[model samples]
Target: MATMNRQHHLRGVLLASVACILWGISGVAASSLFMLNPHITALWLTQVRMISAGMILLVFGQFAGVKPFAIWRQRATALRVVSYGLLGLVPVQLCYFEAVKFGNAPIATIIQYLGPFIISIYFLLFKHVTPTRPEALGMIMAFFGTLLIVTHGHLNSLAISPVVLFWGGLSAIGVATNTLLPRPLLPKFGAVSVTGWGLLVAGICLNVFGPVWQDHVTLTGAELALILVIIILGTVIPFLMFAHALGYILPTTASLLDAFEPLAATVFSVAFLNVQLTNYDLFGGMLIILAVMALSLNGRKMINFLRSFRTE
Candidate 1:
């Protein structure tokens, strides 16, 4: 029993780490595409990503006996699906891409780490739940970390443009909303069904603004391959792996391992994209990751608090 438990723990860690690494790499892949085609907009990339990944995951859900369309049986659930898609998933996808476009992936990813802090604040304001000591400390760390990144440790000047900061801040809200909104649906419909449908709905909605097929950006063979990698390796596989790993390990453990995402993003951005980072960037990023780690220590309380928001 002990050996089997140990094996499951190790498997969980590996799955979580690889999922985070792939997520980080996917951001770099998006950054590479942005660099390759200055004409490529984050809106277009997000639409394509949501549409393609949604369809693929829906197909996978069917094969897995998940009954993807069953989520639409009830009006409430159907509406929730649409809301989750539009308000939760779409913003995260679109804003994240925009952040990456304006800044590098590392900056975007680290900023998105503010999601937990946002959640904590929500609990305080709305739920009347006070954050535990660890949660409070983590929030302070995240604030200072983000401050360092924006100011480069100097309040007089900004390191990144205000535009990047704006989108990145919105992206963090998107992350928090996405994390919060999907809790009720996952158990009933399964992550595969909820996520797949949510993506498709968001994609369809985005299409009303501008269809991807109408976009006129020319793609080389290499860029096409990178898009495929972003869709498959970056989005779909990592999501599946991370979700599955949750079954084998504690949520706290999985959340801690997710810190690898920023590290992977920074490494890949520097190594592949040749993006430069200063000491302030590295140190700020470190603090943000540490904040995430601290929050992960309070994962159980956070989960319970989030669950309080779920409808009966």
Candidate 2:
């Protein structure tokens, strides 16, 4: 029994690692597509990715006996799907891709990783929750890391464009929504089912603005392949693994393990895309990763503290 449990634990870690690797690599792939076609808007990519990946996940879930469409059968679940789709999924994709469009994937990813800090701050200010030592340390690390990344260790001048920073910061908040907003729905339906329906609904909502059909962008073979990677590796696989990992491991452990994502993304960007990072980038990114580790490992303690505060 011990050996079997150990094997399962190892398998979960491996799957989570592979999922993060795929996510990190897929961001570079998306960056390549954006580089090839400067005219290809982020909106187009979001629409295509959400719609295609969304359907694939839903259908795949059905085969796995997931019944993704079960959400539509419940009024509350159906409403949650719409809310998650529009506010949670759509904004995150739009902002993350737009950040990638403006900047390289590595920095954008590191910036997005600041989501947990944002959440911690919110709980501190609005929820009247005091952070424990770990949470406080995490918040400080995240803040300094973001500052270093943005200013490139030069607190006086900005390293990247202000426009890119705007989108990246927004995407970080979007990450918070993506993580926290789905909690209620996750208990009612499996993560896969809720995620699929959310993605589908998000795609539909995005399409209301203007369909990609209205675009003049042309897709080459390379572009088509990259899109497939983004849909499958980036969107579908990561979600599936991260969600599945929760079943076998603590969410905090899973979150700590996901630090590999930014590392992988950085390596891929430097190796394949010839994107170079400064010393500041590496150090700042490391600090942010430490923050992530702190946040994940200490999340429950912080939550308990928050509940105590509320009761008192």
How do the residues 1-312 of candidate 2 rate in per-residue lDDT, one tens digit apiece? Answer: 999988888888887888888888877988999999887888999999988888988998999998777778878768867888887887678888888899989998898888888778777788777888888888898889888888977788999989789888888888777766776777667888888888888987887788768877888998989998999888898889878777777667778887887898899999989998999899999999998898888789655654454344
Worst 10 residues of 1 by lDDT: 303-312
The local distance difference test score of each candidate is 0.90, 0.84
In candidate 2, list every pair of residues with a backbone clash: none
TM-score of 2: 0.94
Model 2 alpha-carbon miss at residue 253, Å: 0.9
CA shift of 226, model 2, Å: 0.6
RMSD of each: 1.0, 2.6
